[model samples]
Target: MRAMVIEENGGPEVLRPSEVPDPVPGPGEVVVDVTARGVNFIDIYQRSGLYEVPLPFVPGMEAAGVVTAVGEGVEDLSAGQRVGWAMAPGAYAERAAVKASLVVPVPDGVSDEQAAALLLQGMTAHSLTHSVHPVSEGETVLVHAAAGGTGLLLTQLAKARGARVIGTVSTEAKERIAREAGADEVVRYTETPVAEAVRELTGGEGVAAVYDGVGRDTFDAGLASLRPRGVLVLFGQSSGPVAPVDPQRLNAAGSVYLTRPSLAHFVADRQELLGRAGDLFSLLAQGRLDVRIGGRYPLADAGRAHTDLASRRTSGKLLLV
Candidate 1:
């Protein structure tokens, strides 16, 4: 099988396309003939050595495709079933051997590319809006990177949960994208000071919570956008890692609650994983959530995908196939 392998973590060039041995399924595992792989910030961080993986790693975390073979002890899933995962690794290849426990059957109405795009970003949106803050009517929330992959999905999900979403983006193009995703307000952070704009929109009261992913550039501003007892969920460090700050900042900033969340903790068990994937795909199937696959590159073009994501030059979901 052809795979993009990283001998050592660095830039996109470190991801070298090479021919590797075909994956074989072990007990409780399944070999998927991968058709599409999702590009995410974590992939960029892993490739850049920020989020270190052992040397010689495959650089993708999510993908969707056919079940070419099923391992022992796996039932109810057979060869040729279409499936996707939120936590599987080594997906940037022709095939991946994943524990069957982690894979979910793709819904009938969703295409393969859409499945690849939505699995991670959609599930994150689901977990965050449904768990982290659980948006409700008469509540307000702010989403950073509102035009990015997770941001767009989170925007729709928050609105679906009945919260008014105020989103921050870097450009006019992104502003349109955020608005189309159901954000009631969009702030061009590149033009206006995002915090000030958010406060102005909220009548200077602030939001119920801020779901921040643009870490260093937006962390302080995100904290400032929240109301008393609001929560700041900092999930990704897109612009950069936030500097160490005083704990008093949260208290002084309105008794805010801060959480650094990751998908791993949210899908800690098979049941949780299945539940999240289920809800996400169901929403997509039902036309309630839109997982726009914004970009696609061939399997060998994984490097370009990483470059685009890290540079913040792409929006919605990116896929490698």
Candidate 2:
């Protein structure tokens, strides 16, 4: 199998394509003949040493493919079944050996690329809107990087829940994308203060919650963009890791709630994993959700995918095919 392996983390160049041994399924595991793999910011973090992992490891966390082999104790899933998984490491390869618990059935209508693209970002968006803060009807929320993969999905999900969405983007083009995703208001945060813009959009009331994936650069603005007792869900640190926050600051900022949630914690069990993925798949099958795939790289071009993502040059999802 040809895999993207990182012996030491530093930059995008560190992602080297090499021939590696094909994965073998252990007990309760299944080997997938990967057709597509999703490239995410977490992969960048791991490649850059911001999120530490064991050396000489494959870099992807999400992928969709046909099951080639099923290990002992795995009864529900069988060989040749189409499946997808998120938060399962070693996916940047031709085959991925995944725990049966992490694999979710890929519906008939969704393509392998779509399945790979939807699972991680889609479920993250779902968990953020439906669980982290639970957006309510007619309420307003703020989403940072509103044109990115998770951003667009999060915006649409929030709108579906009837929450008014205010999105922040770096360019006018992204503003248009955000609006298309159902954002009620879009602002170029590069030109204006994000908190001030959100406050003005909500008539100075701020929003019910702020879904922030760009940490450090957007942390303070996201916190300040919330109303009294409103929550700030910091799910990623694309810009950089946020510094240690002072709880006193939270008290002063209208008693705002702060949380850093991960997909792993949200889908700790098989039931929760399937539930989230199923909801996203249902929405996709019904044509209610539009997943924009910005780029597709061959396994050999995994390094370029990382470079583009880190530079914020791509919108929607990037996939390895």
Candidate 3:
């Protein structure tokens, strides 16, 4: 199998396209003939040495494909079944072996490519909206990087829940994309103070919650944009990791709540994993959710994908197929 192997964690160019042994299923695992793989920020983190991984590893976390073989003790799924998985390492290959507990059935109406693009980002958005704070009707939310993969999905999900959305983007092109995703307003954060704009939009009252993935760059603004007791869900550190600060800062910032949530913790149980995927696929099948997949690279072009994502030049979901 041709896989994208990182000889060492450094630059995107460190990724090499090389022939590797095909994966074999172990007990309670399944080998997937990967059709598509989702490129995420965590892949960039791993490639850049921000997230530690053993040397010479394949770099991908989500993929959708056909089951080529199922290991012992796996009875519910069979060979040739359509499926997708998140949290599966080594997905930047033609094939990967993932635990059966991590694989989820692809709904009849969803395609392999779409499922691959949506799994990690979609579930992350679901956890942020439905699990982290569970946005309710008639509330408001501020979504940073609102044109990115999780941003678009989170915008739609927030709108679907009857919440008015304020989206921040760095470019004008993303303004249209965010608006299409049902954001009530879009701010070009590069040109204006987004926290002030959100306050202005809400008549001097901040939103119920702020979903911030851009950490250091947006942390100060996120705190100011929240109302008293508003929740700030810091899920990623795209700009940079936030520096440690006193917990009293939360109290100083209108008694706001700050949380750094991770998808792994939210879906630790198999039931939670399946439930989140099922809800995402159901929404996709019903045409209620629109997943915008912007880039697709072959497994060999993993370096270019990393470059684009790390440079913030890609939007929606970037896929390696």
For candidate 3, write residues 113-150 as lDDT tens digits: 99999999899999999999899999889999999999
lDDT by residue (9-71, candidate 2, tens digit) is: 888888888898888999999999999999999999888887889897998999999999999
Over the stretch 52-164, how does candidate 1's per-residue lDDT look in tens digits? 78989887999999999999999967898999987778998999999898898987888889989988888888888988888888799999999999999999999988899
Clashing pairs in 2: none
Please give the RMSD of candidate 1 to the true structure: 1.0
Model 2, position 291: C-alpha lDDT score:
96
Off by over 4 Å in 3: none
Model 3: weakest 10-residue lDDT segment is 306-315
Clashing pairs in 3: none
Better of 1 and 3 by lDDT: 3
Better of 1 and 2 by TM-score: 2
* TM-score of model 1 vs. true structure: 0.98
Candidate 2 Cα RMSD (Å): 0.8
Query: Which numbered prediction scores highest in lDDT against the true structure?
Result: 2
What lDDT does candidate 2 reach at residue 275? 95
Candidate order, lDDT descending: 2, 3, 1
